[model samples]
Target: MKYDVAVIGAGPAGAMASKYAALNGAKTLLIEEHASIGSPVQCTGLISKAALTECEISEGSFVLAKMKGAFVYSPGGEELTIRGKDVKAYVIDRKLFDRELVGRSIDTGADLMLKTRFMGLHHGRISVLSSGERKDIHADIVIGADGIMGSVGRAAGLPRCKKFLSGIQFEAPYDACDAQFVEIFTGNKFAPGFFAWAVPFGRMARIGLAKNAGDRPALHYLEELIKHPVLASRYRGSRTEHVVGGIPLGAPERTVKDNVMLVGDAAGQVKPTSGGGVYMGAVCAKIAGEVAARAARKEMDIKEYEKKWRSAVGRELALGMIIHKSLGKLSDENLNEFISFLNRPGMSECITEYGDMDHPSVLLKEMLKGADKMRLVRLLGVAFKTLF
Candidate 1:
């Protein structure tokens, strides 16, 4: 057992890359196969207070739902809200935000290892199994923020499958929630590639969905989006807590190779339109913990840690993988004419200042120039004929 860095996954991009590689002195470590770090609570913890002030994280450790805007239903139910100026988003409490990011990476000294379980990665070391023994851990650097079916990104071969979606959150005890707005239903009978949320959180509220397992099975599209019809007539006797998961969508051909490196959702950095990835996996795990502590003190050349985490979050996850392949070929009457052209008038404050998930394609090319450019070029020619 040796390490300069071996942050398999304690979420929040392996706890901010083992707390910035043990605050840059290295010798970090932060494994976890969940003996509880943010337990079985797969996402829906909406974010955006400029991504919790770029991971400095502390609005009194969240649970403060003050979103002043967002509502975009329409499967013929048409509706659109978008407002925002004061508070834009926040419904966290993801187990107290993953235990305050693994207690600030064990108070910045790193070294965790709950319930272990990494189990393989020969040459570069790392092969655990914990509790019942079978260890061996070495590293000059390794971080795969295990997630999205991540086994440290398939033991570092990268490509841990993509084009996923299948979500299904829950947390109810409602009575027509609107803790300041955050509903977003969308077409395809509720959820196709993505879209379906409630997210209140002050008095319980998280109802979710993400579908697209080639079209169904995200708990049967979250039980047909809570039996639609305006979300089953608002609450209709709430009481949930379920929460299933699986949400990737696109972008993860390679989040880095050789000496490893792959942050949040194991580098799918999720968001394509809005699947959210805890502020782009904690700002790409704080730029892969300052480029893995300068690739462990100038020993550099891990492809310059994937070109410095693709220059900090590869162009907003490659423009959210091209707006999640053009909103998965719209249709629901083209998402009710793109929600009536994003409810006109300054298009929802330029979609809340370009959904600033850290420069999401520069706010998606400025919300495609206030949209409606010939119906966004006929929805990018139906997203290039449905993703070719």
Candidate 2:
């Protein structure tokens, strides 16, 4: 098969890229390795209102819950309630969400190929194993939205994401203080180098943790997470579904080479602080699609994709990385103090005004303006030095 632009993977990024490519006049094809899209779900499925806008979808059957606030717990078990003015995020069914995205891509003139595994690149063509048969497809521009462990970036010789956070979660019956509020738990014994969370949906919640702890696997942290007084009280000691995944944290130095470019997890377009990829991935995927379409017509350089995407989100991603690093290094004592500070008068108001799930740097900047500089110094240690 031949095409003007070929996008690998049928996830949100790949689907969006192919859709935009076709929308911009490029003949496009989107391929998925799985027989069905979004079969084995991996995400915690919590996304900001901005993420939904980026995906161009409104509340649908995929939206299982609407979150209006969060209740954060310190290591010492101090509680901090942050209430938003209105709904701030959503808990989604990823299987339905992904299918909707791919369906949109197909509606926009992008061809779909299921059960196609990308093998490698050959002589400017893509080699794939489709339905137990090896074949090659010709395309002028290739967009790699295949994910972190994907082959497209490797075949293109592009560098990988800086690091990965190990994540584990399970769905279970829950006792939620407020169905509209998500709960955040932080401390060393529970989730060293990261944090744990319980995102509620009516009487159920997605309980999970992500960590940089190497010796202690995600499962180790999970075992302790469920034992927390808050979790133990809410959890019914039973789980219906479990998920394990690695979340890439930072973008590589480069994401484009010759006729190829990377997007989504393959290019590490995820938020370091939140480990969410959909928002950033959708932003970059549109750029990749537009640039790839132009490049296919010999009217633009693929490097334009890199330049534009970075310009759009580079500062946000970089600042988020700085915050993630500082937070990861904090000791239990430090976390208690940090959460305490955030719980202070006026702090919750600031959070309600400025907290953005997709753009945390905005809140950080706003907080630094009102915060006592000396107090910040004591909390963050050396990693805090990079922020200012």
Candidate with maximal lDDT: 2
Model 2 lDDT tens row, 109-215: 99999999999988789999999999999988999999879689999898889999889999999999899999999998887788899999979999999987648
Best candidate, TM-score: 2
Q: Could you give candidate 1's per-residue lDDT for residues 292-376 as a string of tens digits?
A: 8778676566566667767776777777777777776677887787678767777667877665544657755776676456666
**TM-score per candidate:** 0.35, 0.97
User: How does model 1 score by TM-score?
Assistant: 0.35
Pairing residues by index, what is the TM-score of model 2?
0.97
For candidate 1, give the lDDT: 0.75
lDDT score, residue 169, model 1?
77
Q: Assess each prediction's global lDDT (C-alpha) against the native.
A: 0.75, 0.90
Predict model 2's lDDT versus the native.
0.90
